[model samples]
Target: MKNHSGHDMAGHNGHGGARPGGLSVSENGYTLEFDSTIFSAGAQTVTFRVTGPDGRPVTEYTPEHEKELHLIAVRRDTAGFQHVHPVMDEKGTWSTVVTLEPGDWRFFADIHPAGHDGTMTLGIDASVAGPYDPRPIPEATGIARIGEYTVALGGELLPGEASELTLTVSRNGRPVTDLQPYLGAYGHLVALRVGDLGYLHVHPEGAPGDGSTEPGPEVTFMAAAPSGGTYRFYLDFQHNDVVRTAEFTVRTTAVPRPDTAPGTAPGHTNHHHAHH
Candidate 1:
């Protein structure tokens, strides 16, 4: 894959970081400035802008995933996930309509600013004022059902390690092999750590026209977690000329302790613990 730096990036995106992005409103001198953090309940347009290091709205941007900027918003409980592309005005202000409930919401802007060598994700918190009732994070599960479609996620997410995840799309108990291309790929995956909403946007391993990649039955992605914890994942794909998202709750696999091995020295175990 090619990174935002215009160089070959191994294992997917070249933006260098073991930890996920979108944990803050500013990074690498770029800030996501919101026009307003408070909104009324229901559907409304939210406006924002990406200010560069020069403290001016960034006008030029390198497109990623076929868009100049990708906007993601979700409630604090990982509910009401939305992946949208906002229209940017000449002044660089972006606006998109979002249906929000009475709760705290997070907005993530994933972009590559002009003159920057890597992509960055900036995040900010917003609130919809009303009577709020928070929902609990969904339980970890591999099978997710949406209407008549069933998407079964295979593979575990190992913390801080590149792990392969395969999602098989099936409808009405039949495998879907004619998946249409969306955003230049068979599927787009976004994973957010449960509590902090650390963001990771990942694409499938192969492109739509790549001879080796089939359209459906399975779409594969390589993803890494910042740490051992539960995460909420949203998979977007196109089928029957319509776009759909599948949601999943996944927990990272625990790193095994070496000291538990037979014949291991007790002194070595204590030192390892201290180092960890």
Candidate 2:
């Protein structure tokens, strides 16, 4: 839901248009207005409201993926990424607590109003006051290690289409077969473009309770990329009653030119980087 915009083409991400969610404060008559954009570095409750075209609070929203709204906050350097759901009051104010550090932050609100025809993802920036030490962005990788778990990614991403992606989970080099369900699925995958932190729509292939879906070792997802570029993927899965996320950075494959001879490589290439 974070990628909706007239300019948002899941397969053609680089086309010029309205930026992805978290890049604009207002879109399509809906505004993502926060009570304050400057906050102290610590645990704090951030409050924001959505105003409709009529300049009034929007109180009714249709739920997507079992949540009315998804809030994603990440540091500019991609050092900190947190996806949380906020509670809304009658006044259309949504509030949630998040730990902040010194630096710039990006906030993406993915929502769909009850009366609206489709979902809208709006973006805004918040400045955290403190010693702003920036973090460096790492190279793309297909593997990520969190604690004792290791996740290996397989499959290629093509623009303008739902690419099949398979994620395998292991612990201490042993395959995990009893993974618990997270958010009604065996796993949840989030894709964000490298430069702008543009959110991409990613859907899991099947549900946890489905007879054909397995609990662990292999979790499949269908992801669409708007353009060829560096993209970071986060997979959330639960094992041993603990939930953890695996991070991987990948580049989409390039299309072969019509004039290019057979077996000739295209101008674009794919790269994978694993985060430890």
Model 1 clash tally? 0
Query: Residue-wise lDDT of candidate 2 within 121-152, one digit each (tens)?
Result: 88888999999989766766778899889999
Per-residue lDDT of model 1, residues 150-266, tens digit only: 999999786544557899999999999999999999898889988899888778787887789999989988766656789999999899999999999999744643443555422
Deviation of model 2 at 158, angstroms = 2.5
Report residue 246 deviation for candidate 2 (angstroms): 1.3
**The 10-residue segment with the lowest total lDDT in model 2:** 267-276
Q: What shift in Å separates residue 11 of candidate 1 from its native position after superposition? A: 11
Against the true structure, what is each candidate's TM-score?
Answer: 0.87, 0.83
| Model 1 poorest 10 in a row by lDDT | 267-276
Off by over 4 Å in 2: 1-22, 253-276
In TM-score terms, candidate 1 sits at 0.87
